[model samples]
Target: LQTIKNHLVEDMFASEGFRSDLFYDVQTRQNIVDVVKKNGKLKVNDATMTRCDLLNTNGVIHVINKVLLPDHHIED
Candidate 1:
């Protein structure tokens, strides 16, 4: 369950386009993922982001189609 919760990022996308190779998740502060907007679509790592910037009182929400496991958490 903790792995799932770490998928939520601490930052919010305030614009329609952005790119970063060092975005940290809510948990596992040492873990990082890249966020990029390409061909008008948003992506996290190689996973496509189906939804972006769903706003709420707390923060923003973005949905991706694949599981983003931290490097240390991946099985060999």
Candidate 2:
């Protein structure tokens, strides 16, 4: 489970598109790490217990987790 989580984090870092974004940038990665440190629930170590969603944002509103994270990119 931990291995899967590690792989997912590595994949996110490896993704060129994701790495280019400001919102999902290095700061966000650090924020996620901080969140996990502060809250155990945010730490995802198993595929079955973990999910992610990226939503289109308009100004301040961004919907996420309506369902599981889409395997493909969400059209902006």
Candidate 3:
């Protein structure tokens, strides 16, 4: 389960049309995505991006108002 979850999270790095690695949604489930599309803007979920792209020695960090999930409902 950990292996599969790891893969899912790895894939979620591209959901908002960019790369990300952090989620802090209070209402989102671990494997559920809440999409947001309004005013000609589209994001994977309604998550408000608080911060993004903080470079680190091992990787980058991103902060969002909601959690993210991989495309489980899409046919891949």
Candidate 4:
């Protein structure tokens, strides 16, 4: 799990869409980590999240889990 998280973080930083203010924000990073912990997955499809396809610049993909991840409010 730690490995996956690291990979995601690294990728995010390397991504062109990454914004220093948004991506490096401790609160936002912790929120994403919390979501992964509680739901065993990341809610990549969230409006606030960004996605991109390396193979196809014209397309993008979000990394979502089979199950919905809960937010800080515990809402599903």
Candidate 5:
């Protein structure tokens, strides 16, 4: 879905140093989704990164513990 793909950025966070990136969520009509690294933990809004830097022919993939949906669809 566009919402999920929207969460992905073109940058490789593994070696680039995880500061922050802005993504768009089409489902919520939101223009900015925050992906941040704090205390050595990478978080996509609220989802914590479980596995990271999966190398492939396409690009690197980072696995998160929770689903990255819009705020309205996710519970606090």
Candidate 6:
């Protein structure tokens, strides 16, 4: 759906990537790059990266354990 498409950002696979992009909240700021790099696994914020590089008609989907919100901040 067009609504879904607008909600998603395909920059996760970009050269610089959207790992630690900051977002503004109520005239405040937050760091939404709480990504965790373990052994070889990646977890963004509190959502663990379950899958990646999935084939989608529109774009790729990176599965995660939790539903990520627009809150800024990511684990270092």
The candidate scoring highest on TM-score is: 1
Q: How would the candidate models be sorted by TM-score, starting from the highest? A: 1, 5, 6, 3, 4, 2
The residue pairs that clash in candidate 3, if any, are: none
Candidate lDDT scores, in order, read 0.61, 0.25, 0.41, 0.33, 0.59, 0.49
Question: In candidate 4, how many Å is residue 53 off?
Answer: 2.4
Which residue pairs come into collision in candidate 1? none
Local distance difference test, candidate 1: 0.61
Candidate 1 TM-score versus the reference? 0.65
After aligning candidate 5 to the native by TM-score, how far in Å is the CA of 64 from where it should be?
0.3
lDDT of 2 by residue, 1-76 (tens): 4322322332232122232222221223122321121122222211121333443232222122332232322222
lDDT per residue, candidate 1, 10-64, as tens digits? 6666537464532423233346666655567766666788887788899877777
Off by over 4 Å in 6: 1-7, 12-33
Give the clash count for model 4.
Answer: 0
Cα-based TM-score, every candidate: 0.65, 0.16, 0.35, 0.21, 0.62, 0.54
Q: State candidate 2's TM-score.
A: 0.16
lDDT of 1 at 12: 60
Best by lDDT: 1
| Residue lDDT tens for model 3, 1-76 | 5323422333334225532433322222245543343443334454454555555555555565544544432121
* Residue 9, model 5: Cα distance from true site in angstroms: 2.3
**lDDT computed for candidate 2:** 0.25
Q: Tens digits of per-residue lDDT for model 6 on 1-76?
A: 4323323664435212433444211211222345545555666655567777676777667777775555534543
Evaluated at residue 21, the lDDT of candidate 3 is 39
Candidate 2, residue 75: Cα displacement in angstroms equals 1.8
